[model samples]
Each structure stands twice: as C-alpha cells, then as structure tokens.
Target: MADFTTFLHFPISRCGIHVHESCYGGLPVADPEETRWFCEPCQYGLIEPPHCEFCPSRFGAFKRADISGRWAHAVCSLYTHGVTWSQEHTTTGVSWENLENSVFGRRVCTACSDKIEARFGVASRCESGMCKEYMHVTCAQKLGLLVDETDESDDVIVAVPRYFFCKKHTNQENLKTFQRRFEQWEKAEGRRITVHRRKKALSGAEDALRIQMRETLEETIREEDRGKSNGSVAGGEKIKQARLLNSSTEFFDRFETKAEDSGLSKKEFRDPFYDIKLTNASHVPIGFSKEYIE
Candidate 1:
C-alpha cells in the first residue's frame, strides 16, 4: 500500500545495489562520472565490513556525509537528537549539529549501565511517554525493546523504525492493556451479533406474515369468483366477500403504517467496534526469537 513513486533511489553502478534516498543522502557524493555511482563498500574497496561510528555493529551502516571516513546507522541518525540531514533532495549531509548538549552524551544507557560517549552510538529514550529510561540502539534491541519499522510519508523514501519501548512497557504492560481491550471487544462483538440475529428473525417474521396475508386475500378472491361463475352467490355471500376484501386491505394498510411509525427503515445500528483499533496487539517485542517465544 506504500506509494513508491516519490521514493528516490541511488543505484551503485559498480555493485548494482540500490540505496534508499535517506541512506544515499548521508553517503559521500560520487565522482563526476555520468554512469559511476558506487556504494561505500565498493568505493572504498574494503574487504571487511565498515563499522558504524554511532554503534559497535557493522550492519545497516552508511558513510556519514559530514565526517569523512565515518559511518553511522540510518536508524541511529534518525532517533538521535541533534542529528540532521540535508534539506535539498540532491545534497548529501547528515550532521550532528549540536551534539555536546544532546542526551546521547549526558544520559546513561539503562541496559548497559554506561554513558553513551560520542562516536559510540546515540541514546534513545524509552517510548512509554513517562519513563525516563534511556538506552543505546543496540542495547535497546538486545533488551527486548520494540522497534517498529514505519513508513510515515511517501515523500520520504526510507522506512525508519520509529516506535521504541522498553521490555516492561512492550511485553508486560502492553500485554495487560491489550488483553483488557480484547475482552471488551469480544463483549461488544457478541452484543452486535445478537442484535443482528434479532433483526434477521424480525425480518423473517414480517415476511411470513405478509405471505399469509397475501394467500388469505387470494383465497377470498378465488372463492368469490367461483361463486359468481356458478351464479349461486346470494346477497349475503356478496356482502361477506366485500367485507373480507376490505378487511384484508385495511390490515395491509395498518401493517404499512405501523412499520413507518417504528422508523425501522430510517435508522441503522452502528457497531462501536467498527472504529476500535488494537494497535498494541500488532507489535512484536524485539530481541526475542520467534522460535524461543513459541
């Protein structure tokens, strides 16, 4: 469902790997060759993997545009405060604008119990809204924090992991909250199903009644017509037929009037569960293997 038309990509001519727009923006600019765009690993001609300046891990790393020969993870750059990218679409710049006063250097990581020094990755706060806990991105990942990959806009190409929450909030608290919501949803769904069944039963009864009324009216007409064809219908018989026909008409009219007065056709029942979203149930806690959880 993502619109990929607006997502810009830079293809490495040498390796044929296409980099995301945000990743390419932080990478060093290529040489002035018409068909020569190379990624950091290909350009630098390194056999070993490049280390991320922000984290100890070498995975998901890109060369920093501001600092020559320095690398950082795209997720780290996004979550870290004071980190900024170039405004122009074609420019390459990811700078630590004012990192001295940033929380990365000030706050101690809760997971590793160490201050996140400069060039050793940035600190990311717990996303529980009120928790003052901070952790390095790698530490957060190792400690079962929820890092949700989200695409907020089509204008930006890179899908960043925006949502972060500690294990307590993600596993325990959110599980309890979701269980409560699910119970409520089940009750509401039961009520809606009951209402639907009752409505269907009522409609079936109405149809049955209408069919009976129509059959009765048709029988009356047939009997009257047979009497007329036989020429044996008396005045009394004629009067009885007329009364039966009038009664049937009045009954149908009364049924229609009652249905209109009940406003059954004017309103509809709306389910409260239609708009209820259970977002907490969808997110899986990080740092845990699926096999282990199972």
Candidate 2:
C-alpha cells in the first residue's frame, strides 16, 4: 500500500516487498527489507552504485548534464531532450525546486520511459496508490486519458487538475482502487485550490464538486448530441437560411434593378474594375490654350 500524502517511490521498488528480490539490482543487499541496504556497492567497479535518473535500470555508459546534475540512461537522455518542456512549465506554474523536492528526484515516467525532469515536465503518479507508476502530461493526452480542460470560466485555464488512474482500475472489481485514485486526486487538487484562492480569491460558487459535476454534465451533453441525427435543429435552420439565400429569385431581381439604376451592367456588377491611362503633363490647362483664343 502507498501513502496518499508522501510522494510515490520509484516503480522498480514495487516488484517485491523484499528489495533483494529485485532482479534489476546490480548487487544484493544484506538486509532486503531495509532501504539503506538496497544499493550496496557491487564487487566489480564496472557497475557503479547510483540508480540511473532516467530509467529504473542500472547505468552502464550514462550522460550527466549540468542542468540536472544526475546520471541518466542514453536512451532516456535522448527522449527527455526531445520533449518540449517550455509549454508545460508555463502552464503548471510549478517552481523547479518544488518539482525537484516533491515530484522528480527518483521518479521515471512509465509512459515515456524517461527520467521525469522537475523543471521541464509535468507528471502525476498512479492514483491507484499501489505501484509507483507515473504518466507524463503528453503521454496521457495521447492515450485519451486526460480530461478536456477547456471551459467558459477561468477555472480550467487557471487550475487544470491532472489525475492518473492505473491500468488495474479499468475493471469493476477494482472499485477500491478507483476510490483511492479519486481521493488522491482530490488531495492534490486541494492544495492547488488553496493557491488559486490566495492568488485570485475565488468564491465558493465554483467549488471542486461543482467543477466536477459541470464537467460530467458537459460530457453527457456532448454524448447526447453525438447520438442525435446529423441534421440537428440548429443545422436544419442553417441549411434553410443557406437555401433561402440561394433560391430567392425576387431578392436577386431587386438587387439587379438597383445595380441597373446605379448605371452598373450585370457584367460590371460581377467584376467591377477601372482601367487608367497614363499621360504626360500638358503645359496648357484643360479647355484653354497657352493663350486665350479670339
């Protein structure tokens, strides 16, 4: 079982209760139960002790950049570098230090298999509160797991909550798992709401429950709309307007009469344009010669 308050431990630790049973470990610990003994120095200097920052694997030949000060697997490094972090950073409004301390230190996203960067990426641990599995914002979107955050109010723009549900929760038997996930999501969102309230002083009108209910209602309406006939009441009205505009011969006749009264030919009305001829300046004025004629 995982605690809802404390950050999730790395996923690799979920393999077995006894850490020594982990096959990925380079060396076995004297006391498998204790965290301190999990990463005892290996006999061979070839495999160093520290866990790779990017993946749940032991490092062989790794890369360490000054920005993160941590070693990561070659593939993980490549993947992390490829991610566009700037947009996410701006949206989350999370400081690098808070991200580092609370979210990213030992965590790796199960979706991308890349080391979660505190400064660059936004991620959430599995809401199941069982495994240490995590998902990146982009990966969740790609999977269609993320909720549509757009709404008429600033609530969506200001504080879009990201919730993560583990794969196990897909079945009805895992109702407890689902409940745990929701509880965790609410717990996390509570802190976000506090910050939002302080910054904008949002009233109780848009409570967490209201926002959730509104989203549910909106989703239901969308589904209902989709189920209806393609030619909806609104769609039919639009078609009628288009047909009226197309078939109104009297209106066209009136327009043509106006055009004729304005001295515009049908062809000219369709493609009205002017042709100008360039001429050199004349010394004499128009309708008058250089000297007045007798």
Candidate 3:
C-alpha cells in the first residue's frame, strides 16, 4: 500500500509534482485561486537552481513560508532545532518559532571547524544519543559522513545523513558492531534464499508425484475392468482400495521427507535485530550506540 501520509501531490500551475510533507511545509501557502499556485522554478524563469537561504546549496530547496523570495533546504530546516511548521499537517507555515540563539551560536561544525552562523547555515546534530556534536550539511558530506540521498521526485532530491556520529564516537567498536549486524543480515538473506529454492523444488516434486499417482490410479482402474471381464470383480476392488490407501500414505510421506531434506524442521529463521532492546529513550539502533546488544 502507498503511504499517503509521507507525501502530498500539489498542482503547480499546469505541472503536477509530489513533494514530501517537510518540503511542502516550507512552501508558501497557496493563493485563494489554486490555479495561480506555482513553484519557485516555474514562478522564476531561472535556468539554474535557486540557492538555499539557510545553506549554500541548490538541491532540495523550498520557499520559506514566511519570507517571500527566500528558500531553504527541507533537510536544513528539519535538523535546525526550533524550526517548525505552524499547521498540524505542515502544509502551510514554516518558521523558526522561539529559536534559542545560544544553542545555534554554541554549535561548532565538527567537520568544517566553523561556528553555525545565524539564519545561514543549519547544524545537523550527531546521531549518538549522548553526544552534543554538530556538523554542516556540505561539511558532513565532504568528511564522508553517511549522507543518504533519496530522489523524491524528478526535480527534488532529498539528501540527509543516515547516521552522523562524531569523530569521538566513530571507533573500532562501532565498526565491529556494524560488521556483526551485517553478518546477521547475510545469514538471514541466505536462509530466505534456501527456503525459496526448497519451496520451488517441493512444488516441482509434488507436480511429478501427482502425475505418477494419476497414472497409477488409471492403471488400477484398467486392471479392475479386466478383472470384471474375467469374473473377478471383488478381488479387483480390494486391490484397488489397498493401492489407493498406499498412495495417500506415500503422498504425506513425501511432504515429511521434503521438510526434513530442507532442514525446515530444525530451527526457523528469525531477524536478530528485533531481539535487541533500546539502550535509552532515544531509541538509537544497536550498532549506532555504545551500549548496543551483543
């Protein structure tokens, strides 16, 4: 099923485009006449992408809801603490309501070693629950932080980090934890593949078995007919019943044999990640935290 909550489609003049809720929130509210609503790209006849007001980037830019002719990246606005949308659905207003300058002023980008300037650069915080580190969007990308970019639409590319651990947190222990998780995933994948192959083979075997059973039944009926012609109908009926019962037993036995051969009767496959308990209220995954499940 399509997740309607994640995205919304808006008709911009003649062109229609699907945008994320966060991105849509940053856009200016549509005029009374919906037909007059046009995106920045269509509104301004610009060949090049518009620069973001918050960051020095052209990608994933959305018009600031309050400020006319000003734009900011959805990722930039989201990670920037105190920034919020006015509406419940986030379809209209975007503003930095009750923004604490102390937090913004104090945050020094770990990647670039620069202070996060006011109303210009947004700081993306470290993924570690206890860490108080932050980094700029471009700086994070340049420093090889796990930046995940998703193509939201043909024109919009939403880029954000999957996880951004500070230099202090990025250690051998975390690497080992990641490796362990990956190994578990590989094992799960292997089990799935084996199960699929076994099912396919079992299906083929059942088909063949059905054909054989049909042939046996046809032969038995022919033999019964011959016996009837020779005046031995009662004997033929007993033989036919015995053969039918045997065939039924053999069919069930094949299923048990297949199950044993596939090793499905042993231990069932289960995802290892689900067993892990959250270490803190932040709900950071096992590999990303210091106190992860072994």
Candidate 4:
C-alpha cells in the first residue's frame, strides 16, 4: 500500500494519482483500480467549451495523457507536449502569460500577446508549435521576430509553455484594472469627443517617451565620456573641454567664413597659408610693400 500525499495543489495530489480520489477533489476510481475519472467530481475540471492553454480557467476538461515518462501538467503538455530539450539565451527575464483568445489560436502569453493584439488590433502566430512567440503580423515585423523567410518552416525550435510575466502582468488585480480600463476605452472610443481626447493623450505619451529616450541617451553618452577620463580629473577636464570648444568655434568662425568666401576650403587654406606670412602689421601700412618691391 503506497501512501498518498495530500499536500497537492489544485488538481494534482497523490490521492488524485494513486490513493483515494474524492479526498482533494480527485475522482480517481477504485473500481478497476485503473483510476478512471468522470467530470462531475474533478477538482479542477473545466466544462462545455475546451479549456484553452492560454486561459487561466478553461471551459472544457482535458484528458490527462499517460505519456509514461511525461510528468508535466496537463496544461503544460496540452500546448508544449512535444518539445524535448530547452536552450538558454540572453533575455530580459520577463515571464509570459498565456492569452485565451480565438484569433491567437489558443496558446500565446496574455500580457505580451493579448495586450499587443488589443492595442495594435492585429492577429498572427509563428510558423509552428515550437516557435514559442506570437505577435500581430505587423508587430512581428516591427519587433524583428519574423521577416521574409521561406526557409523558416524548416527551422525547428522547442516551444516551452511560459507562465511567467513581467511585474505588470503578474498582478491579477492590476490585470483586472487594465481590463476595466480597456472596457472603458472601448466605450469611450465609440464617441468622437473621446477619440479626440484619446488621441491627445496618446500624443502626450509619445512625446514623453521621446523625451525619456533622449534623456537616457544623453546620460549614457555623459557616463561614457566621464568613464574615459578617470574619475579624479574627468569633471574638470569636461569643463575645460567645453570652454575650449566654445572659444575655438567662436574664433574659427570668422576665419572659416573668410576662407570660404575667398573661394578656398579649410583644407586648401592650411599648408599654403602656413608658408604665406600672416602678419598683424598694425603699425606698418600696405604702402610699405611698395618700398620692399621697389
């Protein structure tokens, strides 16, 4: 007699697997000892419409496969049942939430895939089950995920079901907030006045985003410049550099203009003018050249 662990989360307990079924919502049948389960008593079983892998709660129940060595959950297997190995990559450490929708074909992250769809109003998916990413057809192009690839169909990568999400997507309350917001948005979009207001808001947001990007770039450039100068002298050096550049530009502008107007470029003015005497004959007049020539 094997002891059944009752410490199972929702639908997966040892009682659900081996021992008494009815304990923790497990309907494991003791009749044939084959562990047969009907829908009426399943702990996490869905009803009617098929339970989508992307949805938190699906409509219909999924039949657990006895894949022998496959110990992954029914939800995990339903989407990514075939993937065997995983490769590592440098990523932003964001989690993916499965989005439950008809257009996205039942298996895409809720936050990334659904938000993009809702915002962009487009629908598309990757080539196959192993591709593991979704986007609006245009966004996929914008984000550089998919671009003219006839050979893309041949490349096979393992698609693991990702349940992870960024901070925004992780909070159920926050998601509800967003849902409410979008609902309001949909209602508001119906009106011309609201549309105008939304356009203004979006414009302001774009402007803010541009400003933020500029600030970030400027800060990064400043940090790089400071890094190149060793901390001790960098600040002083930067000030001196600014002053030097200011003075040089002011002084050279007159010379540059004269040189250009004289039908000569700066490069042309260099070596020839180096040999030609540039004198400030403040006291000496141009007529003094007559004495020398005569």
Q: How high is each candidate's TM-score?
A: 0.40, 0.23, 0.36, 0.17
**Tens-digit lDDT track of model 3 for 8-63:** 45543211223444344423332334333334333342333444534434433354
lDDT of 4 at 269: 49
| True-structure RMSD, every candidate | 34.3, 30.8, 30.2, 28.9
Name the runs in model 3 displaced over 4 angstroms. Answer: 1-38, 44-48, 102-106, 113-120, 137-294
Candidate 4: the clashing residue pairs are 21-26, 49-60, 95-164, 95-165, 96-164, 97-109, 97-110
Q: What's the TM for model 3?
A: 0.36
| Predicted candidate 1 versus true structure: per-residue lDDT over 1-294, tens digit per residue | 111123345543233334565534533332333334544444443334455534544433354434344446555565655665433232233455345322223344566642212113455678888987766665554443535455545755555545567666764334445445445644654554344334322245434433443344334434444544485544312221111111121232344356567774412211221232222222323233321111
Per-residue CA lDDT of model 4 for 155-250, tens digit only, reads 442333423222322222334444454455435324523332233222454344334433443344345445544676535232211111101212
> Which ranges of candidate 1 are over 4 A from the true structure?
1-37, 87-91, 101-105, 112-119, 141-163, 171-294
The segments of candidate 4 whose C-alpha lies over 4 angstroms from its true place after superposition are: 1-28, 33-36, 39-41, 44-53, 62-76, 81-294
- Per-candidate Cα lDDT values, in order, are 0.42, 0.32, 0.40, 0.28
Candidate 1 Cα deviation (angstroms), residue 151: 3.1
Better of 1 and 2 by lDDT: 1
lDDT of 1: 0.42
**Decreasing lDDT order of the candidates:** 1, 3, 2, 4
Candidate 2, superposed: residue stretches over 4 Å from native: 1-94, 113-123, 148-150, 153-160, 170-294
> Which pairs in model 3 have colliding backbones?
none
Best by TM-score: 1
Q: Pick the candidate with the highest lDDT.
A: 1
Displacement of the residue 138 alpha carbon in candidate 4, Å: 22
